[model samples]
Target: MRKITKGIAPVSFMEWVRQKPRNVDDNQWFQELYKQKRWDIVSDLSHHNAREQFYLCAYCCSEISGEGQETVNEHVEARALASHRSLDFTNIVASCKTKGQCDAHHKSQALPLTPLMDECETEFHFKISGRVEGKSARAIESIRVLNLGDNERNNKSLIEKRKQLSHNLMMANGLDPDEGLEDDELLLAVIDDLLTPTEGRLSPFAPVVANILRSWISG
Candidate 1:
């Protein structure tokens, strides 16, 4: 997981969206507000929400089902509105989890880690067992909240990536993949690569992503 500082919505725009009263139940008010702030609501929401969803499951970071695969919009249920600040854009995010789960589980102590505010990429890394482990209590809480292991559809992707990385590393050194590096060692090497980018550091998958590639090669 990487922190995506690129293309973040402007603070002013976020402030504007945050002012809207999203928690209200008046359909007429909501309809009117939606019409009034259509551009602010739609464009920024589309971009930022999609960006958020792309990192983790829109609702739960434990999964990779981003926008288009599920209801990526950060949906707030009537019951959950009580806890929301306002209908502002800051309160919402893209989510794949059903409204029920997003509302019930997200509000609880066991919410999945979100890349938006949680920054699990800074704190967590993949283990040899294919589980995502992190340093913060919030990171661990998020793992439990989203049930990263329970979601086979999403976790399988990470597992496959790790396997490929291990294989690539072994092949690079003309050794069997079964003789892979330790998980922590691989993570440290990845960090080293991240800190040192040799080329094309400004591309979409830049310095940090390059390090991930390096780790896979050195598996």
Candidate 2:
């Protein structure tokens, strides 16, 4: 639900796309290119090739810490046919969302929601219990298709992090850390208080997640 800014494509990447033949629009062809080198086009497209690829989990938006970092996967945004048929930036999303399963579910309905598609905020909400349920059927389906709901450990870890951040914020504001609040309440309070529109920030997903938390708490 939040916008991710860290691994955003650079202007140079657009230039590279421009330099590549506009006629090179074939799904199979791009698939072969991806097979040859996973991020050949991506490297040319973005300056955030280093840390951005490794630290962020594509699905749950959890920071892949400790051993998770080693096991973390960075999936190229293109499907063979999907890429070849279209060269638009929206089609290419660097995601940690794929959870090692492929099925009819993996294929997007139409313009599958990824971090690059910012407006997805309207689709889902986070619960105070740290559960991410969809605001609609499409949102629920998207969460399932991407295996977002299956990663219980990742979600719990993020919720705990939100808790700690909330506690710290309350303490800084001269409020008791144990102010008769449940875990979700404290977390939502922190998000509502601290997160605001910041310029040139990374991780748009953070706010979306926070908003979901807020919705859950308020509800």
Candidate 3:
């Protein structure tokens, strides 16, 4: 996962929250916000977070598309745990639809690593075979909790997709795995492109792709 720099909360949402009755209970206020069907606020938050995350899921790095349930405004600290921050802008992220896997299905389970934190990118290791393993206990917990590598629910799992993407990237760059060309400048350029982060778009499972590419060339 990549780090997302939380942007300012939408002014409209801020105003709405500020206008709420001061004595309202936090949980009640949260319920009210949902009951109001203030999807405009949710849309605003999703768009902003989608951009910040380069249009990828904050948890599994899947490409987020469409306005349907495939993409959702996921609360970083679940509303159940932090009802007080329900409307807090920084507490939300854009994640792929949770159809048994992904972020939305995980609920309030504690994460060992979060994209909000800088070091999260390095907390897991990706294998060329499409397997993902945590670098620490916390990272392991995060993987299981998020179902980052789960393949049971769907025919294609997160790791499987990542492996395909990596292979495609290699093929697109004309890098041959069967040959030993570690010092080739063209190969290095290909690896660099995979490693570099873009401003408004990130390749799915970019970190995993980059790491695998680096190992391929170095080996």
Candidate 4:
């Protein structure tokens, strides 16, 4: 997953938070966001979060529309565990509401590593086979928590999907899956292009593809 550079909280959302009663708990206030139909504040929060992350799920790096059926305003530190952070803007992110992966798989479990950390991008290794492995202990746990398809047993579709996309990218660039390319400059350029988001959005699975490509030159 890519690091999410969180920016300022929405003005309206902060204003609403300030008005909350002293006795009210964060989770209660958070739910009231829906019960009260505070669409304006909720919309602002989702839009800002999604835009900053380039519309990718914070966990699996999948495409997301920010909020609605395709996305949920996910609390990075679950409200059940960290009740105090229930309304903390920095603790929240936009995650795909997929049934058995990413946010859905996460539930209230703690994430030892999260996109909020810069090391997150480097701690995981992505293979052309469409599988990922954690380079560190925390990364490993995070992978399992997010169900990022470390193997076919955990998530076959995601593995196959990543494999197909990354292989296609390699072929398009005239690189072999095993030997890669003899030209290091060209390889670096391709990696840079993949890492750079266009129109505030990266190509689907581009980060995973780029990660696999980088391994070629490093080896």
Candidate 5:
């Protein structure tokens, strides 16, 4: 997964925080805010995260629009585990509303590593086969916790999705993994093209495709 660089929090959300009741705990206050369906604050938070993440899920790097229906405000530290951080903007991210994968699968479980960490990007490798392998123990656990499709057997859907996207990206750019591109400078340019966001959003799985190509250059 890509490492997320969180920027400023929405003013609307902060205002809601200030209005929180003294008697209510952080967890309760957050629940009330969500339970109330305060679309203004919720939409602001979702759009902010979505824009920062390039419209991708913080956990799986899948596509997600900023719309409230498609993107959810996922607490990196689950409320059950870190109640004090319930209202902390730094602890929140945008995640896809897909079932049984990201947010839904996370539940109240602990995530040893998260996108917020730079090491998270290095700890996992996205293969052209569309499987992700952990380079560290914590990374492995994080993969399990997020159901990041460690293998085709466990999460075929995600694997297949990544595989197709990665392949399509390669073919669209005229890169052949078996033959390998010959021009070093041209290859670097292609990688740069893949990384550069268009209209403020990276194409889905663009980094995964870029990573696979990088292995060729570095090898």
Candidate 6:
């Protein structure tokens, strides 16, 4: 998992949330909030969250196209369990569709290890085979609950995708004619680009890519 830096909530959305009636029951409160045509504000928040994640699903690290039911405003804490935080921007994340056994569907109310935490990235190790191993129980549970590596009928498992990506990265870097030459400055530059975040959006599974690159370099 990559670290996600949550930014300040949009002013208008914050103001809207603040104005909601505090005395109402949770269900009523949510009903009113939705009835108020606040979907645009929700969309805005989702977009911002997506940008922070480089348009990738927070759990699976898959690219979210933000098109026709491809994305959802995922509540990290789960609205069923934390209705009070239903409208909380900090509790929200943009995830991919939950039609399959994806994170949103599998995670429900279970609190998985989040990218928002500082130690999130260090919890898991990505292998060149595309498998992810957790360094702790929390990470392991999160991976299982999110179905991060589970194979689906029609779709490639997340690990399979990561493995392919790892192979591709190696192939790209290995193609250099002066690969092990002392003055192979281009090699370092290429590796740096793969490991660092770009000015625009990052490639999907960026953390996985970085892991593969780092292992290759160490070897």
> Could you estimate the TM-score for every candidate?
0.46, 0.54, 0.82, 0.92, 0.93, 0.78
What is every candidate's alpha-carbon RMSD to the true fold?
A: 7.5, 6.6, 3.2, 1.7, 1.6, 4.1
Task: Select the stronger candidate by lDDT from 1 and 2.
Answer: 2
- lDDT (10s digit) by residue, model 5, range 91-178: 9999998877888889899999898998876778888778999989999998898888998777899999999888888889998755
**Candidate 2: residue 30 lDDT (0-100):** 42
Among the numbered candidates, top TM-score falls to 5
lDDT, model 2, position 59 = 50
lDDT by residue (156-207, candidate 1, tens digit) is 5545544455445435434443454456565565545443424423222222
Candidate 6 regions off by >4 Å?
Answer: 25-37, 150-156, 173-192, 215-219
lDDT of 2 by residue, 97-116 (tens): 23432222355344355555
lDDT of each: 0.45, 0.47, 0.71, 0.85, 0.86, 0.66
Once fitted onto the true fold, the runs of candidate 4 whose alpha carbons sit more than 4 angstroms away are: 172-179
Candidate 3, lDDT over the whole model: 0.71
lDDT of 6 by residue, 69-117 (tens): 6777677787777777777777777788855545455556476688778
Where's the lowest-lDDT run of ten residues in candidate 2? 66-75
lDDT of 3 by residue, 67-135 (tens): 546788777777778788776778878899957666655788766578888777777776766777788
Report residue 84 deviation for candidate 2 (angstroms): 5.3
- By lDDT, is 1 or 6 better? 6
Clashes of 6: 0
> Whole-model lDDT for model 5 versus the true structure?
0.86
